[model samples]
Target chain A: MNKSYLYLFVRFVVLIALQVLIIDHINLGGYINPPLYILFILLLPFETPGWFLLLSAFALGFSIDIFSNSVGLHTASCVFMAYMRPTIIRAVGAPADYEAYLNPGIPDMGTQWFVFYTLFLTLLHQLAFGILESFYFAEAGIIFIRMIASSLFTLVLIVLIEYLFMSRKK
Target chain B: MRHILAFIWKHNFFFLFLVLEILSVVLLVNKSYYQRAVITNLTDRFTGSINSTYSSITGYFYLKQENDKLAAENAVLWQSLKHGLVTTDTLTTQLVDTLNRQTYRYTVAKVVSNSTGKRNNYIMLNKGKRHGIEHDMAVISPNGIVGTVVSVSDNFSWVMSVLNKHSKVSARIDRLGQMGTVLWQGQNPDKGSLTDIPVHVKVIKGDTIYTSGFSHIFPEGVMVGTVETIKVKEGDHFYDIGFKWSADLNGLSHVYIVKNLFREEQVELSKQVIDE
Candidate 1:
C-alpha cells in the first residue's frame, strides 16, 4: 500500500506538471488545449474507495485550476468525473478478480475498455468544464466545439501515456 | 432516521457530486466576472419583469399622488414663466411684457370634485388655507383658466368654474387688441361668449383670445380660447363672439392657483379711487 501510495504521488506530480507546463500552453487553434491531467483520475486503481478517489481527483484538479488561473472550473469537472468513475467501471463489467492492485489502464483492462472508459470520462470532463467556463446559452455552440476538440485531444494523450507507461512496466 | 442516514452514506458520492456542483455554481456566480454578469443580468431581467407587473397591478393607487407631484412641478414652472424674467433672445417683439419683479407665487392642488353640467358649476380643490390657498385665487390648468376659488376651509376650497352662468373673465382678441369679457351662458359647456368687443372690429375665426389682465386676477396674456364663431346683432354695441373653451374642465385633475402678491394693494388702490 505504501509503495502504491508513493507511485500515485509521483504520478500526480508528473501528470500535473505535464499538463500545466506542456499540454495547457500548447494552444491548438486557441481553444483545444487538452485536459491531460485527467488521466491521473482515469487510471486510478479499480478498488480505490470513493472518498479517496474523489479527494485525489480534487487535489489534482485544484492544482491545475490554480495554475491555469481558473479557480473552480477544473475542480468541478474533475470531481464530477471522479464521482462517475465507479459507475462507469461497473457498467463496463469488470472481471471477478478486480482488486486493489489492478490499475484501470491499457495493460490491466486491455485497449478496448481503456479507450472507451478514457474517451467517455474525458468527454464528460470537457463538457462540464467548457459549459462552466462560458456559462452562456448564446455561446453553446462554441462550448460544444471546444468540448469535442479538447476531449479528442485529451483522449489521445491519455491513451499515449497509458500505452508508453504500461508497456515499460510490463 | 438511521435508514435515511444509511441511504445518504450509501450514496455519499452522489451527495458529494451535488455539494461540489453547488459550490462550483456559487463560486461562478460570486467570484467570476463573466459568469456573475450573466447571472446578475438574468436576475435583473427576472426581477424587472416582476416589478413591472407589481407596478401595473397597483399603479392606479398612486395616480392621484403622481398627478399632485406633476401639478406641483408645473406650478413652479408656471411661477417662473408668469414672472416673465427669462426671455428668448431671438424675437424682440413686445407681445409679452417682462415684469421687473416677481409678482405671482403659485401652488398646485388636485381637483377633488368638479361639476360642469350644472348651472352653477363649481370645482372643489384638495388644498385650502393650510396650503396657502385663498378665496378668489385664479385656478388654471396647463391649457387655460379653469375657475376662481370662491370659498375656503382648513383643507379644502371651492372654485366657481368658468362654465358657470355668473363666471366672468376680462379677455381680449390677441390679433385685434380689442378688449372683451368671457361669460358662460349656462348652456353649452364647450363654448363661452366673449362680450364687450366693439361691433366694428374684425372677428376672425381661429383668432386667439387671451386674458387682458384688467381684473387683476389672471396675469396678462394667458390664453383663454380661440374664436370659433362671431355674431353681430342689429344696433348691438358689442360683437357676441363664441370661443372654444381651451381647458377640459370636466376632466380636471390637477390645477395651479395663481396667487398675485400685489392683489390686495391693487384692490385697495381701486377702492380708494372709487371713494374719491
Candidate 2:
C-alpha cells in the first residue's frame, strides 16, 4: 500500500510537470490545447478510494490551474472527470476489470477499450474546460471547434504515453 | 434517524462528489472576474520558483535571437542621437531649465511563462511587487502592446495577455482619427478586431491603430496594430475591423511594464467629470 502511494506521488509530480513545463507551452493553431495532466486521474487504480480520487484529481488540476494562471478551470474539469470515471469504466469496461489487473493501461484493458475510455473522458473534460474558459469570451461556434480539436489532441498524447509505459513494463 | 444514517452512508460517494465539485465551482466563480483566489497566491509562490528555475535553464536557448533583436533596437536608438552634430567647445553657460515631463516609468521584465493558444491566456513575469510592478500597469513588448498586469506577488506578477477575451483596449485609427475598441474576438492570437467605428467612417485597409489614452491604464499613441480586414454588414452601424497585432504574444520573452506617475491623479480628475 505504501509502495502504491509512492507510485501515485511520483506519477502525480511527473504528469503535472510534463503538463506545465512542456504541454502548456504548445498552442497548436490556437485550437488544440491538450491539458495532458488529466492522464493522472485516468491512470489511477480502480481501488483508489472515491474521496482520494476526487481530492487527488482536484489537486492535480489545481496545480495545472496555478501554473497556467487559471484558478479553477482545471479543478472543475478534473473533479468532473474523476466523479464520472467509475461510471465510464462500467459503461465501456469489461467484466474482468479488477484490481489484480494492475491499473488500467492499454496492455490490460486492450487498445479498443482504452481508446473509448480515454476518448470519452478527454472529450468530456475538454468540453467542460472549453466552455468554462470561454464562457463569456468566445463564440459558440468556436467553442465546439476548440473542444473537439483539444480532445483529439489529448487522446493521441494519452495513447502514446500509455504505450511508452506499456513497453517499459516489458 | 437510523434509516437516514444508512442512506447517508450508502450515498456518501455521491455526496462527496457533490461537495468537491461545488467547492471547485466556488473557486471558479469567486475568481472568475478580477478577484484573486487566496489559494492561488500560495500556489503562485510555489509555481513561481519552479518556473524561474525552468526559465533560467531555457533562457540560454534564446540568447542568440534576443541579442540580435537588442542590437537592432540599439541601432534605431543610435540613429536618433545627435552625436554626429559634435559638441561645440565646452563651458558655455547654458540655461538650465530642468523639467520633468515624463509621466511614465518603464520597468523591464523577463517573461518566464506565457500562453497564447488558450481562449483566456496569461503571462508570468519574473518581477513582481518588489520590483515596482503593480496591478493594471500596461505591459508592452519591443514591438507593441502586449497586456496588463493583473496579479502580483512578492517576486512574480501574472499578466493578462491581450489575447485574453477580457482584454479590451480603447483604440484609434491613426491617420483617419476614427475611434474604436480593440479586442481579441477569440481564435487567432496574432489578430484582433477594432469595433465601435461607425459605418459612415471610411476605414481604409492597412490603416494603423494606436491606444487612445481614454483609459489611463494605457498611454495614448502606443502602437496597436495595422488594419487587415474591414467588413460592414448592411444596416449595421459599426464596421467589423480586424487588425494584425503588432506584438507576437506567442514569441514574447521580454516585456516592459509602464507605470504612469499621474494615473491616480488622472483617475481622480476623471471621476469628477461623470458627476457634472
Candidate 3:
C-alpha cells in the first residue's frame, strides 16, 4: 500500500512537470493545448477512497491552475471528473469488472472499455473546462468546436500513452 | 448525533465532492491573481522559475527573429538621434509643460513566460518589486504596447496583456486624431477591436493608432496598433473597427516597464478636484 501511494506521488510529479513545462507550450492553432496532466487523475487506483480521490484531483488541478495562472477551471473540472469517475466506469464496464480487476487501464480493463471510459471522461472534463472559461451562451458554438477538437486530440494522446506505458501493467 | 454521523459516513463521497467543488468555484469566482494564498505563492515561485528555464532553452530558436527586430528598432532609434524625418522630440516635449523634465522611466525586463492562446492572456516578467516594478505599470516592447502590470511577486511580475478581454487602452487615430478605446473581445492575439469612434469620423484603411495617455498607465503617443479593417452598419452610432497590434505577442521576449513619475500627483489632483 505504501509503495503504491509512493508510485502515485511520483506519477503526479512527473505528469505535472511534463504538463506545465512541455504540453502547455504546444499551442496548436492558438487553441488546442491538450492538458495531459489529468492523466494522473485518470490513472489513479480504482480502490482510491472518496476523500483521497477528490483531494488528489484538487491538488493536481490546482497545480495546473498555478502554472497556467488561472484559478479554478482545472480544479473544478478535475474534481468533477474524479467525482464522476466511478459512475463513468460502471456505465462503461461490466458489473463484475471491479471484483475481477485490480485496476483501471487499457491493459487491465481491455481496449474497448478503456477507450469508452477515457472518451466520456475527457469529453466531460473538456466541456466543463470550456464552459467555465467562456461562461457565455452566445459563444456556445465556438466552445463546442473547441471542446470537441481538444478532447479528441488529448484523447488520442492519452490512449497512446496508456497503451505504451501501461501495456506491462496487466 | 450518531445517526447523523452514520448518515454522513454512508454518503461521504457526495459530501466531499460538494465541498471540494464549492471551494473550486469560490476560487474561480474570485479569480484574483494577487490573492494571498500560500499554496498559490509557492506554486508561482516554482512555476515562474520553471517557465523561465524552459523559455531560456526555447529562446535560442527565436534569437534570429528577435535580433532582427532589435536591429530594426535600433536603426529607428539611431535615425531619431540624428534628427531623421520630422523631429518627434517636439511632439513628445509638448506633453510636458516644462522642458527637459522626464515624467516616464523605463525598466528593461525579459519576458520569461507569456501566453496568447487564452481568452484572457498574460505575460510574466523577470523583474518584480525588488527590481522597482509595481502594480499598474505599463509594459511596452520594441515593437509596440504589450500589457499592464497587475501583480508583483519577489522576482516575478504578472502582466495582463492588451489582448486580454478585460484590458482597455485609450487610443487615438494618429492622422485624424480621433479618440477611441481599444479592447480585445477574446480570440486573435494580433488583433483588437477599436470601439466608441462616432460614425461621422472618416476612418480610412491603414490609419495608425497610438496611446492617448489619458489613462495615466501608459505614456502619451506609444504605438498601440494600426487600423486594419472597418465596417459600419446602417444607423449604428459607432464604427466597427479592428486594428492589428504592432507587436507580435507570440514572439515577444524583451519589454520595458513604464513607470510614470507624475502619476501619483495626477491622480491625487484629480481626486482633490472631484472631492469639491
Best by lDDT: 2
Work out the iRMS of candidate 1: 28.8
Computed on alpha carbons, the lDDT of every model, listed in order, comes to: 0.74, 0.85, 0.85
Tell me the lDDT of candidate 2.
0.85
- In model 1, state the lDDT of residue B165: 48
Tens-digit lDDT track of model 2 for B59-165: 99989988998999889888766574465754321322243477899999998898888888899999988898888899998889999998888889999999988
Clash list (residue pairs), candidate 3: none
TM-score of chain B of 3: 0.89
lDDT-sorted candidate list, best first: 2, 3, 1
- Per-residue error at A170 for model 2, in Å? 5.4
Worst 10 residues of 3 chain B by lDDT: B31-40
Fnat per predicted structure, each in turn: 0.23, 0.77, 0.59
Per-prediction DockQ scores? 0.09, 0.80, 0.67
lDDT of 1 by residue, A1-170 (tens): 79989998998999887775445434354446688888888877777887888888777777765443345778888888898888787777686775676778888778999888888888888878877766557767767877887788778887887777686776
Candidate with more favorable, higher TM-score: 1 or 3: 3
B-chain TM-score of model 2: 0.91
Docking class of 2: medium
